[model samples]
Target: MPAITHEAEPAKLRLAVIGSGNMARRFLKQLPDSRRCVLRAIGDRDPGQARVLADEVGHLCEGDLICGTEDEVLTSDEVDAVYIATVHTTHAQLAMRAIAAGKHVLCEKPLTVNHVEAMAVVDAAQHAGVRLVEAIMFRFHPQMAAVRELVRSGAVGEVRHIDAGFAFYVPSDPKAATIVTPDLIIPDAGGLEGRLFDPHLAGGGILDVGCYPVSMVRAVAGAAAGVDFLEPVSLTADGSLSGDGVDEWAIAQLTFGNGVTASVRTGVRMVDNNTVQIVGSRGTIELLDPWALSPSPRVVVRRVGHEPEERAFPAPGAYALQMDAFAESVDGPEPEQVSNADSLGNAATLDRWRAAIGVRYPFERDDAVIPTVSALPLRVPAAAPGGDRAGTGRIEGLDKPLSRIVMGCDHQPDLLTASALFDHYVSLGGNVFETAHFYLDGQAERQLGRWIAARGIRDDVVVIGKGGHAPDCTPEAVSRQLVESLERQGTDHLDIYLLHRDNEDIPAGEFVDVLNQHADAGLVRVFGGSNWSVRRVAEADAWARANGKRGFSMLSNYFGLAEPDDLPWPGCLDVCDAESMRWLTERQLPLFAWSARSRNFFERADPADLSDEVLVRCFYGPENFERKRRAEKLARDHGVSPSAIAMAYVLHQPFPTFALYGPKRLDESRAAFRAVEIDLSPEQVAWLRGDQS
Candidate 1:
């Protein structure tokens, strides 16, 4: 650890307190009066309470204080440091916001509710070059520093085990009672009344008070090893819960990498004096009260066959020491006494402890654990998905039926949002999920994997995985990306795999052979090409037939009523012209068409308003305008949307075809489903295309 530089005399640092509850007031009372720090602002959810806090603290400090909302104080330039004493769940978010705005942060203990979010905040602070310190003030006490020094000096030689516990009983008061009802029970208040027992707000003895013992043990183990922190190899925890299903008392055991073991016990519903004992092979060191700011420091050092030596030290204010350290860290060569890495490690250990005790918050329950069999996911079930004749289609060499209207997942954000959309689609008899390797930075595939594992509905759906896109389109790239996509989706095989882009430079025969290799390994059920010309398909089939391998089973090209005047994106191929339709009709091959509605050119487009760049470059021209106009008249006559009419044009093509649909919400999905019910005769389709009068 690098030493923090201290100035001989420095100006006071401006501070903004983000919460006005009891903890905030306690911190304010303990702030040093040496003019090294000043309380400049108070921000809280309640303006009245914030103003009261501001008035009280303003006289104690050297600044004129004002009250404001969280946003005002966070974005204000007058604040040099932010002390976050908000609820447990809000610590990470507020700290990240302050770090982004170039302000130092002192977040209250249990730096975050969990490890995943804590890592995100720590990463953001490191990137922005800001100091992010956790306010576990007791660690900064002079008594603790003396104990660490004694342990480092080999006073307790070859430390083998540690026993530490912090416990206190919170009596039940009438004001903190739970409101009873027939179907639900609500808490009476927020601060100490309900927030301390609520799981959703991340309140519990484990997160609130047990964290002290956990961090202390970790530091003791590190001190024994001549480091600042040590990660435990395994952790086991058990707890007794309160009426609200949160832990009121808990005990945890951690084993370090160096074979040192430690036990930690904590509670808010029991009575015990907080103490720490470091037991070594030759001697032991004991601290009577270790986790309080006002406890008289009593230390006992005992060696085998020797009388114990008792020592006493003066008590100091922990919160004042913390505040003074934070003030010095504002222009740091290093941040305060606690490093960000130590905070991260502590949060991760607490997260594991919470998991072992089966304690979870509302926001962290989105993902369901996948069941393990020999450390592998279960095989996909064999039930065929529910489908209708008009909404489902079939391809050669594959047994599972696919939905005619495929679900495109290019912009899904997270598992929770994606799960809702997936549930709606399945309810509407949709079964296929179309995604690629690069969608949403590979999150789409990961979310789909978790959703399927959670619902156990893998056999009831068909997953379309695409790879080998553009510049790296080769046999090796295709194989590598297919395996990676399979791993991301948590499946052994893909129902349908398509090449996202075609490489004309590579021989068509080489593409077919590589695809056959995947099929032979049972990794791919059916393989096809996207954006490839009909001539290339024929050439690939000719080579496959000669070599006795599986040929391309489908063609997923752009086919819609409103033809593309020019390519909407570079290196994209559309087979919407007359010759491709004639070839498909003659061969009767399965056609899985993309952008089948002409990118919604008919629904949101008017011939009088062609101002959109995509509309002008892709689907706005004299012929497409005439086609959209005719589709509009047909849609009005048939009581459907113009987009549905365009969909009818693609579905009622010369051969077997399927249209891909991208719906952001449930209503949009329903509109797309309504289009599946509209059937158009060949004559009506030709009339809409302006082929006949």
Candidate 2:
């Protein structure tokens, strides 16, 4: 879609300011000079404050200005765009609501409290097709544009290093008191008792001011290299924390992939030089005040032998320019000053900085609360196909029907990311989640547990827990890890449990006995093995039958369209061979197939690229490549992606099969879900697998 363009005469962009704080006041003051936009409303939690601010700026509006609570302004049809000048923690939530209402948003920096929240908001905006930009006003300043031009013009000659700092001291007051809650922080006293000193509000110098220097470094370095932005390859940081656990001061050294390095320093408890200096092979450029650009905006350039040259850029205030850019974006593309990727990357860097200093907000560690875009809990979509159920298969000992495509939770790093994907999966009628005790050292289990708790859908969803991985593959380790995994998952029992890997040195009967005990105790409903051989599985089941214990009912080995020539991991097994397939068909045991799409083998177009070492080492062969080619041909015939064909091949097996799919993004999960809608005949599946091609 074309960007929104508001000319002087025909149409004016209508905007609403959604906070009554100092930042909101500053933005309101810029309306008299803004040409492309008109003030439509003023909103705040306090209606009196909103009315006061609205009256103060009423003359700038060409129409009747609405004044009410933030929620009212967000839902008002009079507002075309919203300026979110609220506290740091509320940025993501407010932006989400604005996007939900189909309003353009210019949110304050740092975009959200953390990278996870930032990603959620960005994804929401993109999905909604609405404009969303972080309110980093300085980027739209004319002085910064001149700096970028100077760097891009080669005046600096191969930029190699940068040093930037933004810091100031705010005196602590003894009389100030703050009430900290899970979602917000209320201050009894003004200024000193405000959000700046509260951990619940994500208060810190790094997020508040450090973002300026980090963003400047990225912008300047990218201009020198002719790109929009460059991410750092490595970052090392050190900082001090206050009594309330916010960063007092910090310094980080970032190394970029383009051989450029930078040092960024920020603080709220101390004062620093508050300048930016860029060093290149032949010269250096300096900014007296890069962020505020007060007094006079100037840049100083000094070469090896020439005298220092100073240039000045005078224009409208930074806030005015930022507002103009936001208006332009309503019908246009996002401003390059603070694009979606830039905002997400900046948030990620800030997250790393905080992680380095051992600074984590209380909400971040709370497992029972998942930060979501909407206020209501996520539930399965009511209008889904098949009336709230998709294709599913049942195992003998398990009561709940497991979705054909099981969600693998190891790839999600945080609760927000996990919940976003998990919510989408459930919306598509998927109910089973695959988790393991050793994934991320149990972090994945905790995150999944948090998602389940927050959504209050433990009964609606099925959990699969795997334990006793190699090196700890013992009956005793299985029992011990099961207890810990249950606690981490916040569940009394896992619906389906599996041994991650086999320990063939021990008797198969010993492992079966431990599993049966857990099943009897209700800690596990049904038990299986992940990478055990077919012979060992039969041996364990034989022993279970003899002892009148519950036998193994399922297997979770690698099964897909393209057979693997070698194992990716030490003890991982591929059960696509004829012997294993025949055994599974005869025994009628359900198989949970991991790497069902051959770990993205069918998605790779170039068979000769050989860039991915693991893919090359495990799945590279003439037969596998032939299978991939045939899958692509079948996909074209069916008008679907080659990956869809690969997935269909696994689901079309004679035995009950559930494909364990690990997707890192929402779109990937949606695409995986589409595989269930495809149908393939047994002849077509065999042909794609090279059985009769």
Candidate 3:
């Protein structure tokens, strides 16, 4: 699809402002009229703020301003593009909304708090053919280009090191100049107290001020490397936290791929020279006030043999230059000055620094609360052949039915790949798509969300979101992950959810209670355990019975026809032992068997020819080899693939079992469908196992 241009085709571009905060106000003040950008709408969650900006915009443009909800502004026909100066956490979400509405977007930086969300927003923008630029104001500053040019011209003599820092001291008192006092500035509701120090809003020194230094270093390193940007090879950081746990001061040491090293520092509670210094073997260039928010800057160059030279740069408001650049891109085919790579690279670098410094926002931590659910269209089941047949088994306590065969989405590369697989599975009677929060760094859910939303089949399929894998199996971890999973999946509730892995340190009862709490709120319909021992399942069930809460209704364990000689990975549980199998058989609880074909052990002629070392270690035992041989022989007798026989063995078990399969191609998907066609009898299953009884 081509980029969605404004319908009016007027010389002036239609613009809507989505925030009325301090930054937004500064942007409006610095914006030049020659840019031919018409401010058509102003929207904020607080209508009063929106009206204030609207009145100001109306006075300037001499047109009635559209002061309404965000939806009104985004959907307004007069608006061609949106400038988002909202809080950090809302950046990605609002950008996505603007893109989906077929409007261009200039989002306030750091694009998003995390790289994952940033990537998703960028992908969405590209898919929609709309220009989405991060609000890295410094990128558009004329002096920045001058610095880049000088460095590229060898004035810096093969830059090797860069040192940059931005700091300011803002008093803690609410009456401070930086804080609030309607008499001093605009009426500030929360002041800095409401935003700058709040971790939930992703407020921190690194995100607010540290980004400029990181961007500066990346830019200079890119010039030295003759690339747009240089990826960091390693990063180390340390920071001081505010009383509220947000980073007040932070510094990071970064080593780039070009062997260049850089040190960047930022803070909100200290005073330092706000400058960028680039040091090379022969000379050095320093730019004072690199952020250039408030004053003109002095550029000084010192060389090994010559007297130091200082140049004066005409002070230019970075925000004005940024808006002009955005307007040009909106009006023409030219790309934004700050490319997606720059934004994504900067965001990823900041994410690393935050991680190294142990500065995590509420959203990244384990205690983040679930966002309020907005009403969305329920997913409707697709009326397709075998679509209903796929969901054959009925699990107890789940309102929605699930397909007997589960589809794994751990390796889906893109939306097209996922769409193809989703279409194929649904066409052949599959509905349950299994994903974990950690899978693809939460991309699986995002991809599934896009697919389902585009197809309008949310109700037609069952979504099973798994979270709380090992190392984060506490009750709080589970709750927090569940909330993020639901948000990522773009659903209010899940049909069936499970823990991706277990932690034995935490009591099983604790897990049950947290899961049940979500169930009570309709966030989860039916919950279960994955890779959990049978003993742990019993413990949870016993507690659930006593507390009147739902227990693990299903078990997802590593079960298939082949036996494991060793564990596939550290801390992985294989519940195919005789005792575990007996326990499931006697209880008749539904079993979601992962790696149902022993990672395709029987699918290969040479079991030892496997490439997956984990599979080889887990299924290379003599008994398993003998069983694969018997399965192959049975496949020859039954005129089916050995892999199909293995699948059939799991499906034909005495217990209620569903095999989870990951098919990368259509042919493999078809084969999977055919595997279920060959139902094996109890006698046949035993015979394939070489148990003549």
Better of 1 and 3 by TM-score: 3
**Tens-digit lDDT track for model 2 on 374-433?**
554675745336544658877777767778889998898777668777877886779999
Provide the overall lDDT of each model, using Cα atoms, as 2-decimal numbers. 0.79, 0.85, 0.79
For residues 1-693, what per-residue lDDT tens digits would candidate 1 score against the true structure?
999998777888888999998789888987764346788888887767889888777787565676788768888888888999999888877886788689888899989886655655665576577877889987888777777787788887888998988766554673554533222333433346467777778877888888899989898888888888798999998988876667888899999987789999887675665789999888999987677645466789998888998877675467877887877876874543578778878988987888888877666665644222111233332334543344777788877777788888875565645765676577667888988886776789998888787778888888888898888798889999999999999999998898888888999999999999999999999888887889999999999999998888888888888888786776678877889888989988888778777778887777677668887788878888889889889889878888888877888887998888776555556667777788888899889888897
TM-score of every prediction relative to native: 0.57, 0.86, 0.59
User: Could you tell me the lDDT of residue 317 within candidate 3?
Assistant: 77
Candidate 1 Cα errors over 4 Å, as ranges: 1-8, 33-35, 176-191, 367-693
Lowest lDDT 10-residue stretch of candidate 2? 178-187
User: Candidate 2: what lDDT?
Assistant: 0.85
Model 3, span 1-693: residue lDDT tens: 899886764477788889898778877877653355777888888878899876665665537778888888899998999999888888877887888799999888778877656765776677578888888888787788888888888896888899998766556776755532112232443376557789989888888878889988998898888776787889999889977788888888999988899999988776767788999989999986577544566789999999999976775577767777787877566453588878888988998898897777765543233221111222244544743454367788855567777899887765645665666577667888988898888888888887777677787778888988878878898899989988987889888889888898889999999999999999988999988999999999999999998889899988888877776766677778889989999988889998787777887636547567776767777778788888888788778778878887888888998888887654456556667778677888887776783
| Error at 546, model 1, angstroms | 9.1
TM-score of 1: 0.57
The TM-score ranking, best first, is 2, 3, 1
Question: Clashes in model 1: which pairs?
Answer: none
